[model samples]
Target chain A: MSMEGSIGQDGGSENWGPQVTRKSLMRGGLAALLVAPWTASTLGAGGGRESGGQDAEASGRTRGAGVTDDEIVLGVSAAFSGPSRGLGAELYRGATAYFNHVNANGGIEGRRITLKLYDDGYQPDPCVQNTMRLMLEDKVFLLFGYVGTPTVTRVLPILKKFQNEDIFLFFPFTGAQPQREPPYGDFAFNLRASYNQETAGLVDNLIRIGKRRIAVFYQIDAYGRSGWAGVRAALQKHGEKLAGEATYSRGEKFTGSMRKQVEILQGVSPDAVICIGAYAACAGFARDAVDLGLDVPIANLSFVGSENLLKLLTEGREDAGKYTRQLINSQVVPSYEDTSIPAVREYRELMARHDPQVPEELTREEYTPFAHSFGSLEGFLNARLLAEILRRLGPNPDRAGLEEAVFSVRDFDLGISEKVSFGPDRRQGLQSVYHTVVEEGRFVPLDDWGARFA
Target chain B: MSSASSGVRIRRLFQKTRFGIFAVFGLIVLSTSILCIYTVDTELTAEYEINIQNIAKTIADSSVGILLNRDLATLQSLVDQFLDVQGIEYIYITSESGEFLAHTFVPGIPEEILASDHGSTEPVERSLPGMGDFIEVGSPILAGVAGTAHVGMDLDVVALKIQRAIGQQVYLISVILVLGVLASIWFVNLAAKPLAELLAYAVELARDGEREDLADREILSRDDEAGHLARLFLHVARQGAGRGPAPGVGGRE
Candidate 1:
């Protein structure tokens, strides 16, 4: 409920304009009141529902009983309208395609999975509203593919309140620190590598390259703070303090502010630069650094991934190449650009059949497969997990029973990614990361960075 | 004819002279004022649109990098960052498959995203306010990853910025217009001074009955409209002078 936290999700900055005008401010206030009661009622109704099929549903053999004789529903929330709208849409596409394939495959347990999607716009208030709507009005059996750190963070409390009531939130897209920790973390599962793991892997790689004196350029936000903490922890293992650090507000386009930080790093003349920013800002920093004649090799977390960085450099291809060639990134998901991977092949086939219009040329880009692979893998895993829980739900199942079955899952593998196992203390259920570098505008796996973390 | 009738006619002629000069000055001032306001408004509006377009292009360029890279987290961060920018209201990203990915306020997933196959893993037409419909850039996440990254930047902010800029320009233009009106009045008076003097002399001659020298001095020298009017006035004055000349004409002797 902190305003700073809320700012990232609810278009908090949008309040400025309307607040400046009394007429619009009054209108906004009225709309909030009108929407408030509706949201409350929806949440109240969702909370009141409980099914008595717990015993039959908890046995771990139902496979697909969540969609039964009367209902077939699936739910998802993605950044439909916010900053990460592009990625949200891609993730949605991947999920939708999988659902299409499922529907085309005659569905599971003799019912079509009707996917009910809500646009949280990558903000929490709407995410909570949409989640409530999905559970109450849409009556989805479970929530799958929710995205964003602040978004997932906001809805966690509500989701936990409904946890015992049979609403299961699964496979959140963010790997924020608290999301991977205990207490606040429960019910949801994360397939992506935790920020800690990603940073640890990145630090390990930097050390392997014999690079010392690291500088961190990060967005001044939770995501950046989390990555910075991880970097600090990793650096501690080598007994080194950061050489230089600079921070910028998220979405800030100007690099002038970061120039001072770049100068500090240049003074130290670090061999590697650890940039924790979105594609544009990071690229901006890189371009700015190169402009200032600082040619350090750059490494970034999985947040930058490969596709975004390449696109960022594409504009300044010649300039970017001079510095980007030495760039490295850590990924939690399999590299889609690596066709040698079986998962990538299956994902490619799925995209072709269910969504053929997705350009075939994208396969050439390294990060294209990465996004597709992660999204497809998430869909495949969520489906597999749901199916496994359903099979355990027996002949008749309800929401509570589904939660029990899902939490009981141990050493489950969907063939595309790592085996997922969860216990009373462990809710995230997956912890692995892979390191990759951009070569010829494609992500090529360098090594299994997860093993280093372990 | 009575002496009183001639005196009354002379007074009436003086009144017409004042009215005619004022009318010419008013016409010049009004036309110039209207033209100045029109030109300034047009230029201001055009400049406002151009500024908005520039902002839009910047947003688009940044968005392209975010989308093509499939960096949702960074993209989300960018959205929050841009929220403070003068003219952006919301940002939305959709995948090539028409899957709503992330948005500013509304969750990217809606029933339409699940039901419609329009995006179908290909870059499709997506509509955004201000920017209209743009083709969502379809960047393959990886070799196997296929999806479109649809980004919507609410240009309302840009539009609003332009609006504010235009508002300021309007205030400035209003100031300029007031000055223009006053300057036009001063200029008209300065330019019409010589003509006013010529008309006064012709009126004096009509009253004084000065005839013999009036014909030569009062003839129109040029074919321009003002010159023709001058000649007509002189002819009328000469006729009046010729009819009653002897008293004032003794000076010529």
Candidate 2:
């Protein structure tokens, strides 16, 4: 299949609040706000105060990292143009949509939030360079919504280097164990449940349903290994092991890797296949499985980008192979279609209200798809959590204050299934995971699995 | 308010003793540590109760087949995995009739669990201080038959974890307090030293009716509370004896 890793899973992955502060424009520091888009070029030279030296009690706004009197600027270094473009682009859009919505509603304590992005192009090497630029050159208040495992691996060491500066990297778009584990995770906070939680739900559900001969299809990298290890652990819980396994190289494009995997998987004819890769490749494997008359269901981990993979599997047709039925994609977030959850409804309303434009190539329905994307939905969830935490920082907000505020978010409801929480020793958010099966171009919850297609 | 001046209080014999000072601050440190541990322990217990319930739910949620097929061997082995997990007391499965089918513990059901309707997967915690602190979770194994999965977790694990965390924090707090005590002791000595020197100079001047330079006492050069007291002492010594060095005793160096 020529459509390998290069193909965008975009079904995957803001604003200068005022890059430069208008010094004493109003008699009071925060009495009034300038309703203007912040440009990064004129980053205020006024916040010359030394790091952690300026106490919150010293002024109305503590000057450190990306905070100033009027607004806070958040920096991101994710692939908006390359392999993981979908995840990066959608995550940004989702967070920005919420930020814009908040700003329109008078912002946090009258200080608006701004997001600045550095395109790492889904490559780790660029991640190293781009993070430096974001940290030193851009001086974002905090880094948010980073995408990809390779990128996070490079960012962690650099994060440690600048740890003393009181900057927190919030909600990186990775479930890789490294970011969730200690030491590397000290400066990191995660919004999504880890891949381990996702795969455990997937493998456990499958095993419960009598799918004994479980196989795995994974990308050949840390991301793939994370899902693989989770599946192995979950199976071992059932006193079982993997029936078969296959792997594809990272960032490898259209390289008959799916064909080789199909050849390897068909021999064992596993009862179910748990795939961990980008949408294009995982969809290719599922498509080839269907074409080859492999009757068993081919499930994918959340990393497969549910909608992106579904679009590829269905290819614009609702009834292709009855194939969508055979596909079970585990998710870190609830399905976009299930609007009963307050967070999901808010996500749809906020997305539709704030960012109404759909890309020209997509049909209105496909672009919106029950008016949601799993990636955007997740992004929206993260933004909501971020906003709630920022609100808890009170009037004199700083990175240190923000960290304290985040830790105080105990059992805070995010309107979605998972309750967001943080502690002095706890960093990850949303321990709960959900599973979905595709039905007519939509991902329906797995608990609703048998009833719909019946 | 006890309006006795702090100077008089500090000069009191009991207050000047190391044991008295340690008792005052040490009680505060001990009380604060105990209060913090109590608060943290309560929060950890609540959080872990939910965690144990969720774990039980996850186990039952994944056991739909074993329970459906009535596979006792798989059930025992599956629940056995949790045996090695810290804090879990027992994992038991029951038939629709409330009979114990398989268990990680001995071949019996707890009288407390068997007394309730095992149909509900809802988790309940019982704090039997002498017996054991336990959270028993029950999940429906079958749709109609009402077979259930039960897991009981001991809350002592969470208490132990909190104790360890608080223990580490208390250790650090003790280190900081020790340093603070040592600093206070040095400061108390520092204040007493300059006072003693000034008083000795004042006595010598009053007795001999002669002026001596208190400025040579090093501490008088440094501006501080002691220096201010030293200057006052010199003035008092001159006033009590004579304004001009008794016309001959010494020059104002």
Candidate 3:
């Protein structure tokens, strides 16, 4: 396995050195040192760099921060620890696998892509600190692959605060609306569908199958609330409402009991329950709901990390099918098992080839990496779309042209069934949401929701 | 005066003086201990209440903008960090419409909080059924338009601190009382020794009428008031002895 060098925000590498270095790299190092103090002052907390103005002018080109002649360093702050670690770890693997393939094939216009990674543990404050470090200390070209809604929502303000520095967050792995709405929407380019779209599709399909009384079990944060709002709106369209609701805190582990939440939702006799939480909590809820005999269909959003959720539910269980029965998960990315899709075939091939590991320093907990997951597939597509944008930026890429380049991409095919398109009004690339169910120990796309669920 | 009776007189004086010292020191210790315990309990309880309220205010002030924007996620993050302060058991925020915006409850928002008065600006001390006592304080964000922030400080922790403080005060006061008793006993003995000896000498002289001299010269050295009085009495006694009972000789005269 070829390991790519990951530079931390402290200008240090994670045991792996960049194999691609240009003659100007030493000067770039010097320029970074001269640029650090100024960037540190301008961007106090979650601030961005202004770039070395005289240096860029001297070169007669608008050189962005974190971009040398030979490489572009992007920042990634996600949950590499805690209950959501699988999401972060797998997402990084997926993105890096694609990037590794790109770099191996003589790089993008002879410049290799590197990630300056930090662990936010799926928290907001640490995410904010990581963003500030990435922007000011590491001077990353842009922020990419931020994992959760809470972390990304907090980072949005920082992105807006440093918008003058031309810092944009690309394809965060959340379906939450904060990065999709106004005031903060312009700062992020999302590749995944919103939670509203996911919940609305779930609710709409469930309603079509006569499951009108829907209840929600959410993770009591912006992510949960976004899904809750989506469910509510979707139910209102059919002249119905949530039968009941329950919430759990973020960072709740799978071992923690969800009996109380189960009892709360069970009392209302909801026909179906939609969970908008991380894998651990959602799995716990599903386990307890089954153990307590709450016989109803349980649906989850894509953010749940469906593979990890199923793994927790079925791991060490004598009756795995009993727990996994009637479980539905909504996803923004197509199933990785569907190799008929060009991207899926490419993703599976590259994931096997690169097998990128979460940097050793970020792996605070022991996690067995999945060979292929929806999370990494989305990450692969994110990296693919970013590479396309960077390619469109031509041989000389600057942060100033990033937004225009992203917008200029119209009807771009990511080798998936859904065509990705972006414009001045549209910040999100893909708007389609797919639903799936467990079939033979894996999530397969549910072609006929009414037939299977009914 | 007979020596045996003189010794008895000194013993009686010592007993009386020691009893008086014990009584006085015992009362002082009891009163001081009560005062200290009261002071500690009152001060600690007041400080804890003030600290919790200040924390609630700080959270509310920081949450105003996030709440106004209706960013429940950031508002939750804002309130969640304050839980690290010791004794801060829970925190919750409400929107201007009196709906729950964010809270730090694990299972769910307790019905006690849901039913409690969000309109109250005053801090209310509550006994949550299973969660123990709390001094629930609220602060209005943006003059209550952005809604209210409530912080529940665990009163059990405050009570435990106060108990520890009071226990330490009692220990200190008890030690002081014991030391006071010991020093009082020694001081009383030192002060009453001369008087006790003088009384014994008088008793002897009343019984014997005369002696060659004061037996204990340390008490009759004519250096201070006790010495001068002892010497003067001895001289008068010798003179009277020389005059041989002028007023009432033998029986009644």
Which candidate has the highest DockQ of all?
Answer: 3
For residue A307, model 2's alpha carbon misses the true position, in angstroms, by 1.1
Tens-place lDDT digits, model 3, residues A201-313: 99999998989989999987778877877888799899998898899989999999999999988888998999989999999999899999998899999999999999998
Q: Please give me the DockQ of candidate 2 compared with the native complex.
A: 0.01
In the order shown, the chain A TM-scores of the predictions are 0.74, 0.81, 0.88
Residue range with the least summed lDDT across 10 consecutive positions in model 1 chain A: A1-10
RMSD for each of the candidates: 18.0, 23.7, 7.7
Candidate that would win on lDDT: 3
Where is model 3 chain A poorest over a 10-residue stretch in terms of lDDT? Answer: A39-48
* Poorest 10 consecutive residues by lDDT, candidate 2 chain A: A1-10
Candidate numbers sorted by lDDT from highest down? 3, 2, 1
Q: State each model's CA lDDT, in order.
A: 0.54, 0.65, 0.78
Runs of candidate 1 exceeding 4 Å displacement:
A1-71, A252-261, A264-268, A315-320, A356-387, A447-454, B1-253
- Which 10 consecutive positions of candidate 2 chain B have the poorest summed lDDT? B1-10
Q: Is candidate 1 or candidate 2 better by TM-score?
A: 2
lDDT of 1 by residue, A152-233 (tens): 7656666666665556677777677555554345666666668878888778777766775777887655566567667777
Write down the TM-score of every candidate. 0.52, 0.54, 0.82
What is candidate 2's CAPRI-style docking category based on DockQ? incorrect
